[model samples]
Target: MDVVALIGRILFVVLFLGSGFAHLTQTEAMSGYAASKGVPAAKLATQITGVMMIIGAVMILLGVWSDLGALLLVVFLIPTAVLMHAFWKETDAQAKQMEMIQFQKDLALGGAALLLFALYAKLGDDLGLTITGPLFK
Candidate 1:
C-alpha cells in the first residue's frame, strides 16, 4: 500500500469509528437531536445509528466485505443528512449555517462511500486472493 492510500484509509477509519463512538456515548442527546428533526423516538434512532456505524467502520477497517461496508455507510448517511442534520430551510440564520455545514459534511461522507463502492473490486487486489485447488496452485 502506498502512503497516500494508506493515509486515506486511516482517515476513513478514524472518521467512521469516531462517529460510532459519538453515537454510542451520547445516545440521549443525539436522540433528542433526532426528535428535533421530527424523528420518532429519537433515543432509539441513536442506538440504531450507533450500532450500524460501528459495524460498517469495522468492516471497512478490516477490509472484509468492504463493498457491503460502503453500502451500509451510504445508506445510513442519507437519512442522517436529511433527518439528523437537516438544513433544508431554517429561519434562524446561525443555526441554519451550522446545520448546512453539517449536512454538507454528511453528503461528502456519503459520496466517499459511493467512491468506495466504485473502487471495491480493486481493493487488496495486489494481494492476489484466489480460489483454487491446492494442486492448481
Candidate 2:
C-alpha cells in the first residue's frame, strides 16, 4: 500500500514536474503566449509560477508539507484556468474547444490537488514513505 501510494504520488507529479521545467526553460516562449492572453508582467509571472510549480511538485513528490504543496498548485491552477484557458474568449471553434479542454483539465487537476491537501492534512503521518508530515497538521 505504501509503495502504491508512492507510485501514485510519482505519477501525479510527473506532469507538474515536467511542465515546471518547461516553464523555466521556455520562459520566453511561454511568456509570449501569456502576454497574448493578457497576462501582465508575463515574463516575471511566468518565472515566478515556474518556481512555484517546481517547489510545489517537489514538496508533494517527497511527501514533505504536501498539503501546502497542493495549495500552491491550486493557487497556480485557478488563475491559469481563468486567465489562460478562457474558452469563451476564443473566436475559432477549434481553438475554443481546445481552450475549453485545457480549462477543464486545470479544473480537474486543481480539484485533485485540493483533495490531496485535505488528505495530507488528515493523514499526514500515516500517508507513508514521507520525508515529513503535512505542514498543516
Candidate 3:
C-alpha cells in the first residue's frame, strides 16, 4: 500500500515537476509571454514559482511536510490560473477555448492539491509517514 501510494504521489507530481523544469529552462520565453500578460516582474515571478513547484513536488513525493507542499501548489495554481489563463478576456474563439481548457486544468490541479493537504492532515500518521516536519514546525 505504501508503495502504491508512493507511485501515485510520483505520478501526481509529474506535471508540476516537468513544468518547473520548463520554467527554469525557458525563463526568457516564458517571462516574455508573462510580460505580455501584464505580469509584473515576470522573470522573477517565473523563477520563484518554478523553484516553488520543484520544491513542493519533491516534498510531496517524499511524504515530508506534504501539507505545506500542497499549500505551495495551491498558492501557485490560483493566481496562475487567473493571470495566465484569462479565457474571458480572449476575443479569438479558438484561443478562448484553449485558455479555458488551461484554466480548467489548473483549477482541477489546485483542487487535487487541496485534497492532498486534507488527506495528509487527516491520515499522515496512519499512513506511516511524518506529516509534520522541521519546515512545517
Candidate 4:
C-alpha cells in the first residue's frame, strides 16, 4: 500500500514538476503568452509560480508538508485557470473548446489538490506522516 501510495504521488506530481521546469526554461515564451492574455507582471508571476510549483511538487513527492504543497497547487491552479483559460472570452469554436478543456483540466487538478490536502490532514498520523513538517522530517 505504501508503495502504491508513493507511485500515485509521483504520477500526480509529474505534470506539475514538468510545468515548473518549462516555466523556468521557457520564461520568455511563457511570459510573452501570459502578457498577451493580459496577465499583469507576467514574467514575475511566471518565475514566482514556477519556483512555487517545483517546491510544492517536491514537498508532496517526499511526503513532507504535503498539505501545504497541495495548498500551493490550489493557489496556483485557481488564478491560472481563470486568467489563462478564459474560454468564454473566445469566439472561435475550436479555440473555445480547447480553452474549455484546459480550464476543466485545471479545475479538476485543483480539486485533486484540495483532496490531497484534506487526506493529509486527516490521515497523516495513520500514514506515519505529518501534514506540517520541516522537509522530510
TM-score of each: 0.82, 0.97, 0.92, 0.92
Model 4 C-alpha lDDT per residue in residues 32-108, reported as the tens digit of each score: 99999999999999998899899889888988888788889999998899999999999999999999999999999
Off by over 4 Å in 3: 128-137
Q: Name the candidate, 2 or 4, with the larger TM-score value.
A: 2
Q: Is candidate 1 or candidate 4 better by lDDT?
A: 4
Better of 1 and 3 by TM-score: 3
**Candidates in order: C-alpha RMSD to true structure:** 5.2, 0.7, 2.1, 2.8
Error of 4 at 10 (Å): 0.2
Error in Å for residue 110 of model 1: 0.3
What's model 2's lDDT at 15?
91
lDDT of 2 by residue, 1-137 (tens): 78988898898889999899999999999999999999999999999899888998999999889899999999999899999999999999999999999999999999999999999999997986889988896
Q: What's the true lDDT of residue 94 in model 2?
A: 100
* lDDT comparing candidate 2 with the true structure: 0.93
Question: What's the alpha carbon RMSD for model 2?
Answer: 0.7
Best by lDDT: 2
lDDT at 9 for candidate 3?
84
lDDT of 3 by residue, 34-57 (tens): 999889999999999999999999
Query: What TM-score does candidate 2 reach?
Result: 0.97
In candidate 3, position 24 carries an lDDT of 100
Q: In candidate 2, which residue pairs clash?
A: none
The global C-alpha lDDT for each of the candidates, from Candidate 1 onward, is: 0.73, 0.93, 0.87, 0.87
